[model samples]
Target: MLVALREWSYSRILLVAAFLSIAGCAAQLAPPYDKTVADGLNSANTEAMTLMAATSQGTDKNSFSAREDTYNALIGTLDALALSAGARPMPKNRFTDAINKVLEKRGGKPIDDDDSTPPSAHSIKKIAETLTKMRDTDKKQGVTAIEAQAFKGQLVIYFDQAITYENFLQR
Candidate 1:
């Protein structure tokens, strides 16, 4: 009888532990946005821009490849940041509208493609040139400092708000 009782107690303990483990995993699956992730994304964006600038100045194939890879990584990081910020995946039209807003702000023309090939080295070089020119203009007009600070502040606020929303949802 004592052995049976011991077995029963052990089984109950195991059951309770399993339940708690499952709950813990569920919580972690949707954990809140910590400072590390936010900072990492910001750093990645800066690094990508720097690489792009370097690639534009020379004909080094390796630099261009690195710049392209960094740019793609930045895009992924931005998307993840948006997700963590609680920006719901909008419908196709809404997503297009959001993208258009950025494009318009940058005076960029929209491309009409559904899974187009990635930009070639030549195209990347051209983009880098354009970015260099824009950077120069920003410096000349004293806009770079203002814009960079404003963007950083805006991103921080946006992420903070997102964390608030996530907290609310968790509750």
Candidate 2:
């Protein structure tokens, strides 16, 4: 009877181990980190800060024409980064989605929207839009020191959020 009990306990342990191994292969909700994307974000953020500093200091006399190429390049970089982020595959959570929908129907705050775009992508896109608007404003009447400062602050916030989100995905 003692030998039979030992065998049964060992078998139970093996079964639990196998089950855990299978569970460990479950899907990840967020996409895997892309070093290229992170590098791009860092580089772009540096460039953006430099450009904004120059603008605020009136280095180019706040002339959009003087820095048109720079603005275009920065905007292009941000747009590319956004596209790269959006291209990554994010896993679906059907159970969570169903629960969120039910909660929403019951008047609970919605956890998320139907849009599949990642937060990093959305944040990057917002930065691009802000840059475009700044470019347009400079073209019209040149960016005032106050306006430049405000835009710089906004860009910093956006960049921080995007970079943080990308770093989170690394873990």
Candidate 3:
């Protein structure tokens, strides 16, 4: 009976240790407070407005191709920004140090950041998805003017949030 009790205690200790170790490995991103990032969003929003206007008048669908490159560049820039913002500081505990040592010895990867994934569970994902759908060439994928305007509204809201977040981080 004593032997069984000791084994159970050891198992519980190991389980708790494992959970804490796993929780510390997710440092995936960096600081996102930048004026240039806002400028990029503004540029993307302008392109979206132009597309919305053209789509509303039921004219110049082909003209969208002219602005496509600009929109894509902005999206790329935003994605890069989001990637940086997602980064977290490395965990500085003994467990993390030991794990890093082992991985280094075995020539294994230390960490990974999924670019497709947002740096946060914040509004960025919704913003990116809306932007992507706005540029979809397929008629079925095309967003209506009303939808575009709504998305622009979202942009404004998120921009406001970004400003607030920037101020918060600076303090």
Candidate 4:
């Protein structure tokens, strides 16, 4: 009886150790950036801008619900992306500061908690060049290889969106 009990305990311990080892080795095989997030934000921004236009005029009851759903999706995607980046991707840099300024000027409030001075045109140009480089992937050179390439399109889209807002403010 004693020998049987010991053997059972050993088997249980071995099974648990194997499970833990396999769990530790498990990794995500998918791309780092989610395509769903990109699509969600794109649709959400379009819906939001349309909704804003509608509000300025008369509210469209038919579109209201759809717009609300898009807004929710956008918010959820933003939260998920932030969480995924471990809250380190976004910072008060020149490009981001410019984006915040544009948002504030258009929306009458800052979207982020940026306390630094707004970035200069020179800084913005430099950052834009960097972003352009990032977006342009050269497979032969292995530029932005692997999971990072998945983010290029989304990053470009957001950059364009911010530029549009800034231009709107200019107008």
Candidate 5:
């Protein structure tokens, strides 16, 4: 009876120690985001926007080659952001969702035979307007603070250029 009790107490101690060890490991694996992650995300967002602008320009010029290059650049930037965030073990889904929302607001639709050409100049203006509205909404909701700020600036630039291009298209 005495031997059994001693063995049982030792087993409980071992189990508790093992549980504590596992918890400590989990805590170490998911540290909070530091300045490095924030800076990397900012850089990635800038690069993505640059690529998106290039893609829009290529589409305007009807240059198929430029389109692919721009698209590839955009994807590469996005991938880098994802990897960096993952290394920090930060939640990437929110960031990705923010990006998808922006794209969706910008006339994102599935490509089909009926939609072979890019949107018309009028349509592009409408898309830009819609994007601005979405940015405003995001700002109101208090989600994606950094993205909202950056997007507001980008949208202004895009809207002005879009208007100019549309005017040229009309001539």
Candidate 6:
């Protein structure tokens, strides 16, 4: 009976140790959650939706010139968000470090600074690029309703990804 108790205690110790290790590792994977980041993401999504709806049809659809400032401003907001995300510390994975070295030896520009960029930043950057493309399209033949909706869909996906990631970090 004493031997069984000893074995049970050992097992309990191991289980607790494993749980502690995992709990500690979770914090290392990403930065702590920031309320401001969450707020910013929600605000950006709201503004983007409003803008896209306004320009999806009618006179506003082709009014790229008039809305140029709005487009530029949105792009700037995304860029700033990306910068904010990138500024946070994220531990580098060893596998990516090795891959980056190999890419550098091959004289290829290592993608995304050796994967140092946080996922949220990457998503935000993509959002900015998509918006820029939308702006250019508007400047040209002007975005059709179909095109506008398509762009809006893409933007929604990107925004959701970033927002989801930010929320996940809170956990």
Q: Against the true structure, whose lDDT is highest?
A: 2
Residues 1-171, candidate 2: write the lDDT tens digits: 999999999999999999997765565667889899999999999999999978885433345677999999999999999999889866668744666578788986755654476788989999999999988888877777888999999999999999999988888
**How would you encode candidate 5's per-residue C-alpha lDDT over 1-171 as one tens digit per residue?**
999999999999999999897664422212243444345434544654564444332223233443445445444544444344334332334444566467667876832332222222233334334444433443344224454455546654644543343333332
lDDT per model, in order? 0.45, 0.86, 0.56, 0.43, 0.44, 0.81
Query: What's the TM-score of every candidate structure?
Result: 0.27, 0.79, 0.47, 0.24, 0.29, 0.70
lDDT of 3 by residue, 1-171 (tens): 999999999999999999897884655233434555445555655655564565553323456666577557656755665544444333355665577578767877645543332333144445565666666642344455666667667766765564455444442
Report the Cα lDDT for candidate 4.
Answer: 0.43
The predictions' CA RMSDs to the true structure, in order, are: 15.5, 4.0, 11.9, 20.3, 17.9, 6.5
Q: Which tens-of-lDDT digit does each residue in 87-143 have in candidate 4?
A: 223244455556657778999765664343222222223323433333232222323
Q: Please tell me which model should have the higher lDDT, number 1 or number 6.
A: 6
Scored by TM-score, the top model is: 2
What digit string (tens of lDDT, one per residue) describes model 6 on residues 43-76? 8889899888897663344456788898899899
Each prediction's total of clashing residue pairs, residues at least 3 apart in sequence or on different chains, is 0, 0, 6, 0, 0, 0
Worst 10 residues of 2 by lDDT: 57-66
Which sections of candidate 2 miss by over 4 Å? 6-24, 57-62, 95-108
Please identify model 1 stretches exceeding 4 Å from their true place.
1-72, 80-143
Give the TM-score comparing model 3 with the true structure, all chains together. 0.47
Scored by Cα lDDT, where does model 6 land? 0.81
Clashing pairs in 5: none
Candidate 1 or 5, higher lDDT?
A: 1
Candidate 1 per-residue lDDT over residues 79-167, each given as its tens digit: 55544433322234444466657877787775554322111212223333434443444434423444544434443454444334434
Clashes of 1: 0
